[model samples]
Every structure is written in C-alpha cells, then in structure tokens.
Target: MTTSLMHTSQQNQPLISWRWLSLALLVLCIIAFASASTSWLRISPDRQLQISQLQYFLNVGISYCSWLVIAVFANWMRLRIPLFSEKHPKWLLIHCSVAALISLLHILFDTFMLGLLFSFDFNFVSAFAKKVAFWLPVEMVAYLACVVSLSLLEQHKKNLKLPESEQSYTFEQGNQVRVVDRQDIEYIEAYDNYVFVHCANERLMLKQSLSSLAAKLPDEFCRVHRSYLVNLMAVECFESHSDGQAFSRLKSGKCVPVSRRRKMAVKSSLAALHTHIH
Candidate 1:
C-alpha cells in the first residue's frame, strides 16, 4: 500500500477506547469540587447558618468523590470480566456485594464515625447510601444502554443493512492471539469460554473468548446473552419462546437465545435507540 493509503487505513482503525472514562471522571470530580464549595447547599439541616461552613462542603465533596470512585471501580470491574460483552453473573454478584460493602462503609463513616468523632447526631451513613442508591444505578444503566446501542449499529453496518450514527485491549503470548478483523470475522457465536468467530466466509475456525472479542468489537455489536453476541442492527426480529426463552433472530437467519437476565436490558437498549430516532 502507498504511504497515504497506509496512513488512511491506520487513521480509519476503530476509535473505541476507554481512556476517555478517566477524563470524564476527572471532569465530574472537578464539578463535584466546585459544587461542594458553592454556598448552594447549606451546612446544616437548618436554613440559618449557625455553624461554620467548612463541614458542609467537606462532607458533600467527600460523598461525591466516594460515589465517583465506586462508579469507576464498578465499570472497570465490569469491563475486566471476559463475558463476551454480556453481563457476567459474577460481575452482577460482585457489583451488588461491593456496592453493599461500600454502602456500609459510607454509612459507618457518615453516621457513627463522623457523628461520634465530631459530636454531631447526623446519621450520614444511611442518608448517603439512600441517596447513592437512588442515583448510581441510573447512571450505570445509561452508559450500558449507550454501549449496547452503538454495538447494534455496528452490526447493522457490517451487513450493509443500514447506515448508522457512527459514534463508536492487551494480552500475552500465542494464547492471547490478536484478531485481525478483516481476516477473521465471518460470524461470531458465543458459548461459555469462547465466542467462535468463523473466518474465510464460514469455512475456517478461529475461536476466541467472547470477553476478548467484545473488548475489540466496535460499538455496533453487543452481547445479548451469555451465549450470544449478535449485531443488533442486523437483528431482523426478536422472538419469544414458549419455554420462556427470549431470542433475537438475526438477518443471517440465525436465532440466538437471550438469557432471562439480559432480556430487560436488551429491550431497554432498543427502546432507547427508538427514542433517539424520534
């Protein structure tokens, strides 16, 4: 290839990267810092400012930081698990457990720890958890929805079915084989340890774990279940099973089951995209 062509190919390589998450979190941190220092939120329950103002902002800032840390950690953990872009059972378990643990810690710190240390009666722990619970899941769900929607769009593009809004990992050794998307992707099927990516237009076999490929996939493909990652844009119809199994029927005429747990999420993602259209 000519230098210009080679440069263009390099530039056209997928722009999917998570380094932006850090930048986003930093911006949020700055916002929290600024918001905390402002006089908007009062120091105490009372409107009259009787006590010194230092404590209020300090507590708010601390709470914001704590929540931000929890969020970042949760996303990192979710991304770390190799589940082929699907939500892993262990991921959910860990998320709930860690979130609970953090809740307890936040409670202890804000309630007994802070109150006892400062001689204040505020049950900050309970208050903090309550507020955090209210907001955290919503944010997480929104991000997940975005990722799913984008993945679906990518799948559609691959099949030449639709033009989409194109807003779109490391390893070791031969065991950590890097996928050359052009040569290796005929179709992808998700099982437990591996998502079989058929190359050579379905005559060749290259098996890689779903989690690994998911990390490499552009936004147009998504894990619809533990066992299936389908291109949502290529999805022709979604079917319901009499046995309570939900499945997405793809343009390839392939029917893949959507796990019970992921059904709601898949539907929610589709709904979001539909809303975005109008």
Candidate 2:
C-alpha cells in the first residue's frame, strides 16, 4: 500500500514548466528596472545628470539581460553543481568557464558604449576598469536572483509532472521483468514487508519480495543482507568491522549492512565470479 502511494507521488512530479517561469522572470525584470529608475530619478540634478542616469539604466538593463540569457543556457544544459554527483564535474566546469568568458566580453562592450556616450575616448585599460566598475554589484545581485528563481522554478515543475527525458517503467502487481542496465539501479532496500526497486535515473516503485528479486537479478548482483541485495557492478568499496560484520558501499555511497550468516559465502561467490570474469 505504501509502495503504491510512493509510486503515485513520483509519477505526478514534473521536471520544469517554462510558462510559469517566463511570467515570473518577466515580473522580476520589471521590478528591477522600476527600482533602478526610482533611485536614479531621486539622485539626478540637472539635464546632464538625467542623461547620465539614462546611460546607467540602459547599461544595467543590457548587462542584466545578457546574464539572463546565460542563465537560461546554463539551466537548459543542466550545469553540474560543486557537490552534485548526478552530473559530470568537467562538463559543468567547461560550461561555466565559457559563460564567464562571454560575460566578461559583454561587460567590455558595454563599458566601451558607456564611455562613448559620455564623450570619453575608449582606452583599453579604461574600458576594462569601467566594465569592472559597473558589472560587480549588478551582476552579483543578478546571479543571486537567477539562482533563487531557478531553484523555485525547478521545485514548481517537479510538483507538476516528470521530466521529458526520464522514461517511465511500469510493472503490474505480479509481472516479472529483467533489469538489464546496472546503472539504472540506485539501491534495493526492504520495504513494507516486501522488496522495493529503486533507480537513480527515475522514480519507480516495484512490489516484490527480496527472495523473488534475487532470482531475477543478474549474476552481478548478490544478496548481501537478508533485507538487502546489491549490484556488484555498482559497488564502490567495502568495509570490514570488528564484530565480523561488513558493509557493501555503492557508487551512490550508500552503505548497506551485510549479515554474518551470508558473509563467507558471499565473499567466496564474489571472488569466484571475479576470477571467472578475468
């Protein structure tokens, strides 16, 4: 009953909703412009000061828009987080580095335009300095706002429906199926007086017993605990304890306790299998 409830909840979650996010982003952009304009209008004195204010606002708007574009690309590409293990770190680093390079170039171009507007000759160093001067605070706030908004947007989408790329796997109450891809599995844990099948790629709940699942699993999997069965291909490491108990750590870094009864037999089976493969 609980497994069925969990499966239903997972099936209902969505990945993203662009329409709502677009509306929210539009509102934020309006608020930013309004706030900046209100401040500039209060500080300006003469006609020239008003012109300066216009230049400042225009420069800010352009910079913010460019950052928004970059943020969209980053979100679309699904850039990796520092500690996020689901995506590759190298790919994320490359994407962020390229975005940073483009943003820098954008600032340089904006500074040149701003200097030209004020009748100042655009020197290489001055253009860089002016760019840095305007970009720091605006970009900082823009980045923070983008990150927060994106997080909320992601949650909103998750509440709606599943992501497009994650293919759904369904099983009937008594159906038998093969798990061909070892990478699809997260960990198999005992649940609700039955076994639960979990996968990292998508949210799926299967109703079956550990004994039944053991028979269906490939040779790479072994019953490590009475309540747990592990995929050997996904094993990250193993740790031995003083009490003659041990744990099998998975690539996901989840450690499952091994039973003392199955210890020797499991070890021997793994050794024999490893030898046979080589």
Candidate 3:
C-alpha cells in the first residue's frame, strides 16, 4: 500500500504543479480583463491607449504579485487540510477567517506596491478599513470557487483511473508466481515485514508491507486496522464491542479486528455492500 500510495503521489506531483501554473494564469487573465474594462471607462478618450494600458497593467501587476503569494499559501493549506472533504464546522469558520486575512494582506501589499511606484500619499488605516469592506466578499467567493473547482478536477481524474485500479495483482512466493483476482482474496494480515494473503482455503506469505499491498488492492478491500485489510465482499457479519470497537467476521469464519478509527468506515462499507445486493 505504501509503495502504491507513493507511486500515485509521485504521479500527481506534475498534476499539482500544473494546477498551480494554471491558477496563476487564470488569475492573470481575470485581472487583465478587469483592468481593460475599467481603463476603457475611466481613462479620458484623449489619453494615449498605450499609456492607459500601461497604467492598468502596472496596477494589476502589483496586485497579481500579492495574489500569487496568497495562492501559494492557500494551496499549501489546502494540501494539509483539504476544505472540500472537511466535515467539521470549526474548519469552515477557520477558512472564512483565513480568507478575510488573505484579502486584507492582498490590499495592503497592493497599496505598498502602488505607493512605491507612484508617489501617492494616503492614510493607510482608513484605506485598509475601506478596502476590506469592498474586497472581503469578492475574495472569499473567489477562494471558495478555486478550492471547489480543484477538488472536482481531482475527483474526475480519480474516476478516470478506476479501470486501471481494477487490473489483477501478481504476488510471488519463492519459485512460484501467483496471479490473484482481487475478488478472491478474503483478508490480508501484516506480520513484521511481511503480509499474509488469505484466499480460498490457502494463506500465502509475501515479503511486502501491508500498506504497499493495500494500495494495489481493489476498492473492495478496505484497511480495517493498521495490520489488517478485510475484503468487504467476504465479510459475512460484524461483531461490535461495548468499547466502541468492532470486528469483521469473514466468510471463512475468521474475525478481523477493526480499529476504532476505522469502525465507521467498516460499517459504511458493509452497508454499501448490502445496499448493492438489494
């Protein structure tokens, strides 16, 4: 599982990098369009088009630099705590607060750059207070949209790779090479540096980490514990404990302990299987 996870992660590195680049380009396009429209209306008709264009570009260029910084920070935060999958209400509040702060920083940075470029004098406190009222909502919406779009794109990519995930897995034991269908596996148990693959009335030891194996296994096989992976199809029943823990009883009558953290997932998988049957 670890190897497969690492491999998937490695494959996604380029995609992630491309996303950042695409985001920057998208921001640039938005700024350019806004700048052009605003300049056309505000600048005097007698003024040179090049001069108006240059002014607009400079203003947007300074703002874009600030936006780039904010984007990098937001992207980093998204990677660590993805907003799309976040279920806690507190995280929503935190993200809103962060978005407000980002907007404030963007205005401040733009103001600094504009002041340095064209010797303009204004009260910083009043300007910041005024801009916050106008820009906060806009920035918040943009941030949320960006996050949602990226999340959807990621989901689409994963769906596209589902067929690849369904391919059979190969395991080697000494001189014998065994090709196993993912559906035939009942459960897998981790022991030291090796994992025991339990299939129909036979158990085979493979010199691989459970995590690495789990990554390659089909979606039907779920990690119920740090040391065990249970085939949801093979799970005939679940045994619950008073301590909020659970165990999955396989078709072979072997019970696999489900960790506290995985109890809900195990239950959900079982429920899904039951639903599909009906």
Candidate 4:
C-alpha cells in the first residue's frame, strides 16, 4: 500500500516540476518581448535617441532581470501570505501594501541599472516620482497578469488530478485491510489515534490520521475542521449558530462542525461546486 502511494506521488512529481518550468519560460518570453518592443520604440526617425540600441537592450535586460527576481520573491511571498484567503481578513490591504513595496523596489533597481549602463546621473526623488507616475500602472498590470496566469494553470492541473468515481481508499482495521470506494464515503472524523470512516450504513475504524487521509482524498473531500473531512457531495447544507459557529449538515443527517479557520475555504469550495453543478 505504501509502495503504491509512493508510486502515485512519484508520477505526480514530473507534472509539478513542469508547471514551474512553464511559468519560468513564460516570464522570460514576456520579458524578452517587452524589452525588444521598448528598444525598438526608442529608435525614432524624427527625434534623436539618446542611447544606442546595444545600450538600450542592456538597460532593458537589467530592468527585466530585476523584475524577474522580484517576481520570484513575490510568488514565494504569495504562497506564504496568500491573499484572499479566509485567514487573511485584511488581504486586500496587505496585497496593496506589498505591491507598493515591490513597485518601489522595481523602480529603484531599474534606475540604478539605467545609471550604470548609460553613465547617466539619477536624481533619486525625481526618478522615483517619474516612475510612480508613468511606470507603476504598467508594472502592476504585468505583475497581475503573470500571477493570474500561473494561478489559472495551477487550478487547471488540480482539476485534471480530480479523483474518478472508481478510485478506492485502502485502510487497515485490526489485523485485516479493507478497500472502500471513494464515492461510498460520507465523511471521515478523527478520534484519538483512529479515524472513523462513515459510509452509507456502515462505519469503519482505521488506524490513520485525518491529515494523512485528506492528502489521498479528492478535492470533493474538504477539511471542514481540524479533525473532520467531509465529502462535499454528502453535504446537504451548512447550519449557522448565533455564537458564530457553523456545522456542515450531511445528507445522512450527520452534522460535522466546521472550524472557524476553515469556514471560508469550505464555503468557497461549496459555492464552486454549486456553480459547477448548475
């Protein structure tokens, strides 16, 4: 069983690696195009361009390299500090603040590179002001475009990995092992050192952690609480309490309490499911 799980995980490794590689290649292509376009625009027939084509390419390359570094950092930060997550109530404010800081850093690096390549004196305040006025909007759009595209790609990958109805979950009970179809599972709850798997009319106890089982389950199985994993299809509706508590009411009339931390994520998942169904 362990070997099978390991094999499945190994199969997924290459696809995950490819996604990152694709993102990197996409960013490089965008940077190259932008650099070439900007450099071409600098060469005008009517006006005398201050910098040569080689110098302009070098400057643009430096600027794009700086942006690439910033983009990598931003992606890392986005993973750690995910905006628009339930845990992040002030996500918009935090996102805006981070964008401002990134823009400032981008402008600073770009200016430094311009000065280095062109041997031009940079007035810090004036340069920053000019960048903010002219470059910030373009930078913001580019940053958003990259992030959004990568995010959509990730979602597409996840959708492709969604478990089929025939997929089975294996568990050990006492000295015997049993395999249960995923569609047969109503919900899973953690109790002491064992996890209780609730099915249509049978409840099976397995010596496993909820977290471990969650990783193997499909997207339909959501972690509504620290100790519970509820199949979204089994959920009839969500029950609310005056004390700001909530419970997921399953079709079997079983109420699974949802933790405050996971409520928004669960709600979003349910909403997405609803939309998909309709």
lDDT of 3 by residue, 17-59 (tens): 7467757767886778677657756747654574447456766
lDDT of 1 by residue, 54-127 (tens): 34545565566556656555544443432232445564455555565655555455444345335555556566
Task: Sort all candidates by TM-score, best to worst.
Answer: 4, 3, 1, 2
Which number leads on TM-score? 4
Ranking by lDDT: 3, 4, 2, 1
Pull out the clashing pairs in model 2: 13-161, 13-162, 14-161, 14-162
What is candidate 4's local distance difference test score? Answer: 0.66
Indicate the residue-level lDDT of 130 in model 1.
Answer: 76
Q: List pairs with backbone clashes in candidate 1.
A: 84-210, 84-211, 107-125, 150-219, 151-219, 151-220, 151-221, 154-220, 155-220
Each model's total of backbone clashes? 9, 4, 6, 0
Better of 1 and 2 by lDDT: 2
**Per-prediction RMSD in angstroms?**
12.2, 16.1, 9.8, 9.4
Please provide, for model 2 over 1-278, each residue's C-alpha lDDT reduced to its tens digit, 9 standing for 90 to 100: 33432111133223455566656666766776776567656754575675566676666666656765666655544322321223344744555455566567778777666666666443667767766777654554554455556655544543553344233333443344333234466567777766676666644455667766565444456778878877676777767899787987778777878898777545644553444446
Worst 10 residues of 2 by lDDT: 5-14
Error of 4 at 210 (Å): 1.4
Candidate 3: C-alpha lDDT = 0.66
Runs in model 1 deviating more than 4 A are 1-66, 69-112, 118-187, 191-194, 198-204, 241-243, 275-278
TM-score of 3: 0.46
